[model samples]
Structure formats: C-alpha cells, structure tokens
Target: MLIAQITDTHIKLPGKLAYKKVDTAAMLKRCVDELLTLDPQPDLILLTGDLVDLGRPAEYDHLKSILAPIRQRIIAIPGNHDDREAMRGAFHAEGYLPTEGKFLQFVVEDYPLRIVGLDTLIPGEGGGELCAERLEWLDRTLAQKPDVPTLVLMHHPPFITGIGHMDKIGLKGSDGFAAVMERHRHVELILCGHLHRTIHAQVGGRPAMTCPSPAHQVALDIDPEAPSCFTMEPPGFMLHWWNGRRLVTHTAVIGSYDGPHPFFDANGKLID
Candidate 1:
C-alpha cells in the first residue's frame, strides 16, 4: 500500500503569495501535478496540516481546486494555523472529516492498514496539545482495533525535534501521548507535520515522522538558542510504502526545474 503525505501548503486567497513572498498555491499545484504523474499512484493522500495560511473560506476553495486532480482518497487534520470551524464548514460536504465532533478525528479502515486522525489544534495558540478527552478517545479506539496495523496521523509531532525554538511549540502533552502509544503494539507509524521539514524519531517503539511542507521549509539550524523561522528551501512531501510487514518512506521534492544527476553506467562508464 502506498500513502502520499503532503503538509503545510499554506494556501492563500485568490492564489495570492503568502507573507508577500512564497507562491504557495502555485507550488501546491505543481506538487499535485507531480503526484498525479507517478507510475503507481498513491493509494491514499494524508494531508498532515496547515492547509491554509489563515483558514479563510476563499483559501479552502483554492485548496480544493488544486487537490481536485488527485485521484486517491484524502484525509486531513487541522494545524495551529487552521480554524476548526472554518475547515469543517469548507470540507463538511465532501465528507473529508467526521460530522459529529468539534475535532476532526476519525478512522479509515478500507485498506490493509487502519488509519486514525488526531486533532491537536488549540485556539489562539501556536503550540499544540492533545487533551485528556482526546487521549481517552485514542486509548479506546486503539483498544478496539488491537490486531490491525494502525497509522496515527496528526498535525503536530508528539516529540521534540532538535530545533529548540520550534520544539518549544511542539505537542504539549507528549508524555501522556507516548503512554497511550506504548500500550498499542499494533501501531506501525505515527505521522505528523507542523515543523515544516522532514523529521524522524521513535515514540514508544513506533516510528514517528514529520512530513515536509509543499510550500516552504523551516531551516535546518541545530542551534538550541536560535529563533524559530522559515526559509526558502525547496519544498517536498513523503511517500510511505507499506510492504506487508514494514513501512518504508521516501521524500520527493517539488518543482523540478533542474538539479545534479550523478550516475555511472555499466562497464565502468560514467554518465551525468
């Protein structure tokens, strides 16, 4: 099974550039186009978060347009930048989210792997948290599906990435969250976003990864004292391929204008 992960598109209204800088809408369109061209198309698209710059109605409309060409099933959760009410209002008719709750949490059981969406959005806050109620729900849900290979999806990563400033704004209730995962042995992977770059770590023996945004990326500065900010680095996404027992991931960068292609042909011939 193949799962494509796209995060932090940050689409703006009327396809306008964000922060008077990055052309997010265009970049997302290019990413979608690239995904459509893949040989074995992704079975599902997991949108990790930050779908819009400000969660505006028009921004969602623009996002819908860019994603219309994607032929796979799409699942999404809200980020700190997203407004839950606004997201629900925009995607309610499409059935992209649950219809009965304040949080857009639900399960997808159609494939060999069971996928779950967790909401960690906190109103008026840059950081994320999984409250007690949500944790309880997760515990109950995992208990009910102990035998299935599960993939947990959320907007904020549940662990700290070495980037100190951003780490301060990561998931707040990580210890509590880890405790829940520790009990669910069937969980194969924990997928997330919010850091704007690809990150990998282990949480309770489960492989946890943060997908890179398709718009822009947070710089990879390891300084513990550095400030939090974004950079003009190339945007990308992750492709997770589940081959029966293990899940393998590959990162694909978007907007391919040109790059170095070093190669060596057979019989000791160098090709570039």
Candidate 2:
C-alpha cells in the first residue's frame, strides 16, 4: 500500500501570496502535478493540515478545486490556522468527514492497512492537544482492532524535532498520547505535519514521520535561542509505502530550483 502525504498548503484567499512572498498556490500545484506523475500512484492522500491560510470558505473552495484532479482517496484534518466549522462546511459536501463534530477524526479500513485520523487542533493556539474525549476515543478505537496494521495520522507531531521554535508549539499532551500508543502494538507508524519540514523519529518504539509542506518550509536553522521563522527552501511532500512487513518513506521535493548537483569522475574523484 502506498500513501501520499501533503501538508501546510496555507492557501490564501484572493489567491494572494503568503507572508508577502511565497506563492503558495503555485507551489501546491507543482506538488500535485508531481504526485500525479508517479507510477503505481498512491493509494491514499493524507493531507495533514493548515489546508488554508485563514480557514476561509473561499480558500477551501480553491483547495477543493485544486485537489479535484487527484484520483486517490484523500483524507484531511484541521490545523492551528484552520477554522473547524468552516472546514467542515467546505469538505462535508464531499463526504470525506464522518462526523459533523468540530474535529475531523475517522478510520479507513478497506485496504491492507488500517488508517486513523486524529484531531490535535487547539483553538487560537499554535500548539496541539488531544483532549480527554479524543484520547478516550483513540484508546478505544485502537483496542477494537488490535490485529490490524494501523497508521495514525494527525496534524501536530507528538515527538520533538529540536527545531527549537517549532518544538515549543508541538503536541502538548504527548505524554498521554504516548501512553495510549504503547498499548497498541499493531500501530506501525504515526504520520503528522505542521513543522513544514520532513522529520522522522521513533515514538514508543513505532516509526513516526512528519510530511513537508507543499508550500513554504520552515527555515532549517536549529537555533535554540531564536524566534520562529520560515525559509525559502523548495517545497516538498512524502510518500509512505508499506509492503507487508516494513514501511518505507520517500521525500519528493517540488518546484523549480537550482544548485546541489555535484560533479564526479569515473574513478570516484571530484571533477567539479
């Protein structure tokens, strides 16, 4: 099974560039185009949040239109910048959401893998939290299907990435979340977004990954004493492929850029 992950599109209304710079819409289109060209296309597209820059109806409309050409099953959740109600109104028509609740939480069970969407959005805050109710729901859901290979998807990562400023806004209830995952041995991977960069780590013995934003990426400076900011790095996404026993992840960078090509000689000597 193959899964495509896209995050942090941050679509702005009136189709304007974000942060007075990045042309997010164009970047997203490039990413989508790249995804469509892959052979053995992804079985499912897991969109891990900040789908819109401001969670406006128009922005969602634009997003829907941009995603229309994708033939794969697409699942999405909200992020700190999204308005839950607005997102529901826009996507509910597509029947992608299971409940009319504030959060988008559901399960996909038709494939060789069991996929679960968890809502970690916290209103008016950059940080994320899985409240008591959501925690209880997840705990019960995992217990109900103990034998299936499961992948949990959410907006915020539960592990720290040492990106100092971003880490400050990571999942707040990580301890409780870890406790729940510890009981579910069938969960093979935890997928997430919000960092705007591809990150991989292990949480409670299970592989956890964060997809890169299809738009702008957070600067890669690991400065522990500076303020949060973004960078001009080329946008990208992640593809997760599972073949029975192990899950493999690949990062695909999108958009036009220069440099990084190295020259070499037949004798393994640098010829640049």
Q: Which candidate is the best by TM-score?
A: 1
Q: Report RMSD for candidate 1.
A: 2.0
TM-score of 2: 0.91
Clashes of 2: 0
> How many clashing pairs per prediction, in order?
0, 0
Candidate 2 regions with alpha-carbon error over 4 angstroms? 256-272
Candidate 2 lDDT by residue in tens digits, 8-51: 99988755999999888888878889988989899889889899
Q: Cα RMSD (Å) per model?
A: 2.0, 3.1
- When summed lDDT is taken over every stretch of 10 residues in candidate 1, the lowest stretch is 256-265
lDDT of each: 0.88, 0.86
Query: Where does model 1 exceed 4 Å of error?
Result: 257-272
